[model samples]
Target: MKSKLSFLLLSLLFYHYANAQTAPGFKELLDSAMVRDADLKAQQTRNKLTVLDQHKLKDVYLPTLEVSGMASYLNATARVISPELNLQPFLNIPEGKYNNNINVSGFSGLAKADAKMLLYSGGKVRQLNKALEEKRQSENILLEKTSDEVAAVISRAYDQLALVHQSKKVLDEAKRRLDANRKTADKALGYGLITPYDHKKIELAQATLDSKMAEYEGKKELLLTQLEVLTGIDKERLRLIEPVLVPVALPAPQKTIDQRAEIRALDHGINASGFKIKAEQTWWIPKVQLMAASYYIGLYGARVKSSDNIIPPIPAIGYPGRKLDWKPTNLNIFPMLTAGVGFKWEIFDGREGKHAIETARIDRELLQNQKYDAMRKLTLNQANNQSNYNIANSQIALKKKEKEMANNALVQAEKEFRYGMSKSTQLIEAENDLEAAELDYQNAIFNQRRAAVEVMRSTQELDITKLY
Candidate 1:
C-alpha cells in the first residue's frame, strides 16, 4: 500500500510537470519575447550610445592638452657689402678682392605643448550640455516606447495562439459529434430505417468537419511558428494558455497622452531643440579661455662659413684667400612658457549662426506640431480602444449565452435523431451552430484581452514587470 501510494503521488507530480511545461502563461511569453526581440535590443544599444554622448559632453569644459614635435634641416646664405673704401694701407687688403659672403646650415628641432580651458562661453557650453542631456532623455523614452511596442506585439501573438488553441478544441468536439452521427446513421441504414442517401449525408458532414479541423491545425501551426520566432521558444514545446480577459478603465485622454512614451519623447526633443537654439544664439558672445603653452627649440650639427677678399694680390708672391670656417656645434635654447587669457567673438559668419538658430527653432516647432498631432490621434485611439473593450465585453456575454443554447440544441437534436424523430440535416446544422458559437465566444474573449493591452500601451502602463 505504501508503494502504491508513492507511485500515485509520483504520477500526479509528473502530470503537473508536463502540464506546466506545455502551457506557458501570457506573462511568461511576454518576458521571453522582451528578451529575444531584436528591435528592443537595437533600441537599447541606441540608448547606450546617447549615454556615451552625454559623457562626451561632460568633458567639453575640461582643459585640453596637446603636445607636438617637429624636426627639419635648415640652410641659409647671405652676402654683406660695405661702402667702397681704400683699405690697402690700413689693413693691407686689396679692394677688388673684398667679399662678404656668409652661409649657415643646421638641423633644427622644436617641441611644443599647450593647454586650454574654457573660462566663459556666454552660456553656450551650458546650453549644449543641457541639450545633450535632453537628447539622452529622449533616447531613454524611445527605449521605453520600443519596449512597449514589443510587449504589445507579443501580447497579440499570444492571444492569437490562445484563440487557435480554443478553436481547435471546438473543431475537435465537432468532429467527434459528426463521427458519432455517422455511426448512428450506419446502424440505421443496416436496419433499413434510414436511406443510403441519409447515410452519405452523414459521411459528408464528417468529411466537412475533417476539412475544418485540418484548416485549424494549419492555422495553429502558423501561429506557433510566429510565436517561436518572436519569443525564441520552440514551437513544439509551446502550448499557450488563455490570457485573462479584463477590460481596463480608460483615463482622461489628455492625461493618458501626456503619459505616453511617444509624447514624452517629443517633449524632450522640443526641449533639446530649444536648448540648441539658445546655444546657437550665443555664437555672437565672446568666449573666454585660459591658455598656456610651452615651446622648446634646439639646433644640432650647425656650421658657419665666412669668406672675405681683403688680401692684396702680388704677381711675384703666392697669396691665399681670407676664409673662416666654424665647426659644427649643438645649440639649445631654454624652454619658452607663456600663459594668458583670450577671448574669441565671431563678428560675422555670413549669417551661419542666424541660419542655425532658425533651423533649431524650426525643429522645435516641428516637434511641437508633432506633439499636438499625437495628442489628437492618441485621444481618438484611446476612445476607440475603450469602446472596443466595452463591445467585446458585451459580446462575450452574448456569445456565452448563445453557445449554451447551441450546445443544448445539439443535445436535443442528437437525441431526436437517435430516436428517428429528427433528420440528419438538422443534427449537422446543430453541430455547426455549436462550433460557431464556441468560436465566437472565444474570439470575443481574445478581442477583449487585446483591447485591454492596447489601452495599457496607450497609457504607458504596459510594463512587463507589472503585468507579470
Candidate 2:
C-alpha cells in the first residue's frame, strides 16, 4: 500500500511539470509573432523589390535584339514626251515610231532583324549599378529594424498579461483568507463573543475581491485579443507563462548605439545618394553602342506597259496591248547586312541633369544630418532606460520586504481575533495590506522587465536568444 501511494504521488508531480513545460512562454510567442506579423512581412516584400531593381540594372549593359516584318501593295503609271525618231538612225526604224510613254505596277514585302550592344555609357551604368547595390543593403537593414520593432511590441504585451495573471493570484489568496476568517467569526457569534456586524463586514470584503477579479479578467481578454492579431494565433491556444526575471547587463552606451540597425540603414542611404549624384553628373557624356542589322526583301506580280510601235509587231511575241508579265518570285534580296557604331549625347536638356545632381546632393546631406540627430537621441534614450531599470530593481527589493512584513502582520491578526483579543476589522486590514504588497512587488518586477526590453531594443540586441 505504501509503494502504491508513493508511485501515485510521483506520477501526479510529473504530470504537473509536463503541463508547465508545454505552456508557451515569452520566447515562443515572440518567435511566432516574427513569422506572422504583417508589418514585418511587408518590409520583407520591399526588400525583394530592391533585389529585382538590382537585376534590372545588371541587364542594362547587355545587348538587345528586335525582329519585324511588313507587307504592302504598290501600283503606278507614268507618261513621258521626247524627240519622236530616237532609234531611226541606229536601227533604221521609221520616224515617229518611237514615243515616250511609261506605265508600271507591283506588289512587294520586307522582313528585318536588328541587334545593338552597348559598349560605353560614360561610366553612368557603373554608377547606377553601385547605387542600386547600396539601396539593396539599406533595405536589408530596414528588415532587421522591422523585426526588432515587432519583438519589442510582443514583449510589452507579454509583460502586461503576466501582470494580470499575478494580480489574479493575489486576489484569490485574499479571498481564501477572508473565507477562513468568516468561519471563525461564525463560531465566535454562536458563543455570543462577536457582533453580527463584524460578520457582515467579512461578506462585504468578499464582494470587493470578486469585483477586482472581474476587472483583471476583462484586461486579460483584451490582451489576448491583441496577441491574436499580432501573432495570428487563436486566443484559446495562447497559454501564457510567467516570465522569469534575470539581471540585465549591457555594453558601453556609445558602442551599443553605433551598432543599431537604424544607424546602419542611414549610412547606406547616404552612400546610395552619393552614387546617384555621380550618375547624374555624368549625364553630359555620350553613350556609345555597336549596331548591326539584316534585311530580306522580295517583289512579286510585276507587269509593264509601253507604246506598241516601240516593239515591232513580231509574231513570236504572243502578248497583246504591249504588256509584259514578270514571275511572282522573280525579285528578291536575300540578305542586306549593315553594321556600325553609334552614340547619343544630350548637349542641352533645360538643365534637367543639373537639377537631378543637386537633388541627390541634398538627399545625401539630409541623411547625414538625420544620422547625427539619431545618434544623439539614441544616446539619451539608452541612458534613461538604464536608469529606469536600476530604479525598478530597487523597488523590487523594497516591495519584497514589505510583502513579508504584511504577511507576518496578517498571521498575528488572525491569532488575536481567534483569541477574542482583537476586532474583525483589524484582521481585514492586515489582509488588504498583504494583498497590496504582493501586487506592488509583481508590478515592480514587470516594470523592470519592461525597462530591460527598452534597453535591449536601443542596442538592437532584442532577439529571442538574448532576451531569454
Candidate 3:
C-alpha cells in the first residue's frame, strides 16, 4: 500500500528541547521551544533591541568621557640658543645649543581628556525609548503567537493518532467475525446446507471487512507518524500514553477575546504603531550629546652622549649630527582629557518627516481596526467550532445507545438463523446493521474527541507546560 505517512515525514525542521523531564508528566518540549524554536529565537533576539534601547537611555543620563594618547617618532629642526641672537651683554660667549624641538628622531606625546553632557532634547529621547519598548513587546507577542500555534498543531496530531488507534480494535474484531463467518459459509456449502451464492455473499462481506481493516491500519500508521514528529519521538518506539481526557468544564470566559495569542500580538503591534507615530512626530526635536577624550604624549629630543657628551647631530655644515632618543614616556601622553557638549538642531526638510508621521498614524489606525476585525473573526470561528463539538458529543451519545441496541438485535438474529427460524438475507441484514452501528459509534467517538482537542486549542489550554 502507498504510505499515507509521507507528509508527516516531509516536514524538515526541528527545535531543540532539553531531555529533562518536567513535574507530573510534562515534557521539556515547551520549555525547549522557548529557546530553540526558530521563530521564538528570532523574536527573543528582537526583544534584546529594547534592552539596548534602555541602555541607550542610561547613556543619555550619564556624561560621556573619553581618554586618548599617542606616541610616535617626530623629527624637527634643531634649536640654537646663541648669545648674539639673544643680545645679552653679560654673556658674550655662545650659550649651550639644545634643540627643545624634536630632532631627526624624537618622541612626540600628548594626553587629553574630554566630557560631554546632553543639555536638552525636545522629548525625542523619550519617544524613541517608548518606540523601542513597543518593538520589544511586539517580539514577545510574536513568540506567544508562535507558541500557541505549535500547541494547536500538537493537539491536532495527538487527537488524530488517538482516533486512529481507537478504531483499530473495532476493525480487528469485525475482521475476526468476518473470518469466522467465511469459514462457516465454506463448510455449510460442502455439507449442502448453504448454496454457492450464499458462500459468495459471505466472501463479499469478508472482503469488505478486510478492506475496512486495511484502511484503519493505514490511517493508524499515518496518524502515528504525524504524532511522532510533533512530539519529537522516534516513530518505532513512540508510544502515546493514554490521553487525559478533560472532563467538560464550564469555561469562565472573559467578556473580551484577549486570551488568544493572536489578539495579544495584534495589541502589541498597535502599540508599536503608535510609538512609531510618536517617533516620527519627534523628528523635529534637536539631538544633544556629550563628547569626551583623554590622551598621553611624551617628548623625545636630543640624546645624551655616554662618552664625550659630544652629540653627533649639528647643522653647522652639510651634516645635522646626533639626535636624541627619548623614553617611551617622552613620546606618549600619560593622560589627556577634553570635554564638550554637542547639539544638532533640525532646520527644514521637504516635509518628509511630517509625511512619515502621518503615515505612521495611518498605520496605527489601520492596525487597530485590523485587530478588532481579527478578534471578531476568531471569535466566530471558536464559537462555531465549539458548537460543532457539542453537536458531535451529542451524536456520540446517541450512537453509543444505537450500537448497544444493534448488538442485542444481532445476537438475537444470529440465534434465530441457527435454528432455521430466520432467512439468510435477514441474518445478513442484521449483521450489516450491527456493523453500521459500530462504525457510526466509533466515528462519532473520534469526532467528539477530535473536536474536544480543537476546543482545548481554542481555549489556549494545550500548553505542554500544564500537560503531564
- Candidate that scores best on lDDT: 2
Give the C-alpha miss distance for residue 227 in model 3, angstroms. Answer: 2.3
How much lDDT does each candidate structure score?
A: 0.81, 0.81, 0.63
lDDT of 3 by residue, 24-93 (tens): 1224333433344566567677778778877887578677666565666665555444311332244342
Q: Which window of 10 residues has the lowest lDDT sum in candidate 2?
A: 319-328
Candidate 2 is scored at a TM of 0.82
Q: Note each model's CA RMSD in angstroms.
A: 6.0, 7.0, 11.4
Clashes of each: 3, 0, 50
TM-score for every candidate vs. truth?
Answer: 0.83, 0.82, 0.66
Q: How do the candidates rank by lDDT, highest first?
A: 2, 1, 3
2 versus 3: better TM-score goes to? 2
Model 1 Cα lDDT, one tens digit per residue, 310-390: 333444456454465776578887679999999998999899999999999999999999999999999999888778878
Clashing pairs in 2: none
User: 1 or 3, which is superior by TM-score?
Assistant: 1
